[model samples]
Target: PRIIVRAIRTAGKLAVDKVKELSVKIDNKSPEEQRDLLQKCAVTAMSSKLIHQQKGHFSKMVVDAVLSLDAPLLPLDMIGIKKVSGGALEDSFLVAGVAFKKTFSYAGFEMQPKSYDDCKIALLNIELELKAERDNAEVRVDNVKEYQKVVDAEWQILYEKLATLHASGANVVLSKLPIGDVATQYFADRDMFCAGRVPEEDLRRTQRA
Candidate 1:
């Protein structure tokens, strides 16, 4: 009985494979013929049990979406798919912009800049923390005044960097590395949308957009 079931499954798989092979044999055909073959295949596939009865609606939606692209050559990476749990399949639609999976480092600043309209964005590929060079030597600060000066200077540098970004009209800041608490607070006080530790690719796409 197991052998009979295995043979039946194998035959069914082979039949599906053969149908797929024959359906795509439009390489040598003219452009019109190729298009017709593709349309027929689309119809057949959409009519299958998997797609339910929304074949015509889905087919038209797909064609309209492709036609809506700005250029003839469509790079699919420019498209974003956001799936919501409560909506029907027909409720799914295409959005015109790229969406990154990043959140603001500070929850308090989320209410600010609800939109990016006319907002300038700054992309920083570096950490917002302070770095020191000791030359493999330890310097001892004997006086409290001198120790305070060093601390003040380090903070000044970080403040200046943040100020520069703010001066550039950057309402949004995306960093590829962790943003120190001081920097995050500075941005939050300014009501800026700052997100840190974002992926490199996301930063690049945000910059391009």
Candidate 2:
């Protein structure tokens, strides 16, 4: 009976101690102290995870993630983790803003500027490529000049559409459909950034950000 009584007292003491710890407001601590505490907590939380071996890196990422959000109650739903294939576990990182892996293309990708500051972004669902005149529409050109005019008209329509987009003061362009080589080169020539085939989820998240 004495042993059971002693165990009950110890359990009560532990509970009281935990309550006191929990009651302490983290904001009351200094920035450096808070960071240290969070790092230790992150390490402990991931002790059983596969990333435990790289705790130092993962710990910093966790601390950054928490500090960046800076919320009284964590809005965990706002944070997203995308597990991309390839690269080591050490390659994992936390982006303060949204990022996409698959949307960028090789065409004119290297020519355009990579980073932007306070730049306007335009999200489009329409294709930038030249479209057919109409469904089941056929044009019987009598001569070479006639065929050239038909081609020029289609090209002019594409060019005008691109010009209209450029006039919108958008330096960054994202589209759900293919932007194609012609449109890609157009943006690159102006030192702007453009990407096509962007996922719908990415578009929504970008808008929110």
Candidate 3:
């Protein structure tokens, strides 16, 4: 048993060495020759019975997704794959821009804007909600009138932030943090596109685009 184990380990080492030798040979080749070799290897590997039969189709989908970026060097991390179990592989397609799963905080907002030709976007790292300076502050509200005034003051501050965003000629607002209902309603009233609570990485990619 010990002899068999030793022999198997030796064989594994030899296999790894052989792969390293082949990689060095490939690296020493011209760019054109290396590309040709890579293409041939990919084709041969895809032809193996153990592999998925539709790998070529999936490969094309990946290639198309990367090419859609239109950059000389690909930012592959920006490519997002959304898999649905019931769909055929052929039904898969690539989307040009960043795709994110988010919903409008306000119910009445339109999913998309009517015009995008002159759309200027604003990206906000801060939340549209108002933050209290003191978490535990004692407010002496004598009556309903006083309480109403306090609530209105908070709303006014949130409104100002929303107004500032709109005043900046921002047709689309993307926030990395949550946007309050007041802010969302304000944006909806102006027919502006607003998305809140977006992932930080996605926001960075959108800024780059």
Candidate 4:
């Protein structure tokens, strides 16, 4: 649970930072512009990858988590590939697969994911407001809530996909975008959403787009 909390905390911090960041960006733009920008950002966030060190940090954290849980199954030094589980993993290899079984399942869902830590940073975090840039006949700007809902749905899908991969057994090297829920947890405590720490901007951004 300590590892879980840490993962959540890490994700929380990162998401908070992202929200704060994007909010400022939104503030700089008009409502229509801000909404558009958020859409772009969401798409970008989902489709991108993270830097090496950042990915590495999350990777290491995953390794520690697996080791912590499966310690009894393998010796400390024998934890690497070709060692145990045929480098398969003693637990959900943060560096390996999503290993849904590897990590604790929270929020009533399971997703396997490789560390693929970059997913959080690299992706744009965009919403699906323009299912093709709004209907031409509809000149009126879409409501913020509309875009937010779309974005939220997309983010949720993204999070689930990532987590499923991790939980399944990709415990070596992750490549796909992280599941949004796991991504959310990757930033902070699971309680973050419940406690209202999840940035309002992120939530708003998610729902409309």
1 or 4, greater by lDDT: 1
Pairs that clash in candidate 1: none
Q: Evaluated with lDDT, which candidate comes out highest?
A: 2
- Candidate 2 C-alpha lDDT tens digits along 167-205: 999999998888878898999998888888987777876
lDDT of 4 by residue, 51-138 (tens): 3324444354434544344447544433333224443222433443211113222352323332344232222333211133345644
Comparing 2 and 3 by lDDT, which wins?
2
Cα displacement (Å) at residue 127, model 1: 1.9
TM-score of each: 0.57, 0.66, 0.66, 0.20
Candidate 2 achieves a global lDDT of: 0.85
Better of 2 and 4 by lDDT: 2
> Number of clashing residue pairs in every model?
0, 0, 0, 76
Worst 10 contiguous positions by lDDT, candidate 2: 70-79
Candidate 3 per-residue C-alpha lDDT over 73-139 given as tens digits, one digit per residue, 9 for 90 to 100:
5476767666567867678677777777655566645544645776888998998876665868878
**Model 1 residue 121 CA deviation in Å:** 1.0
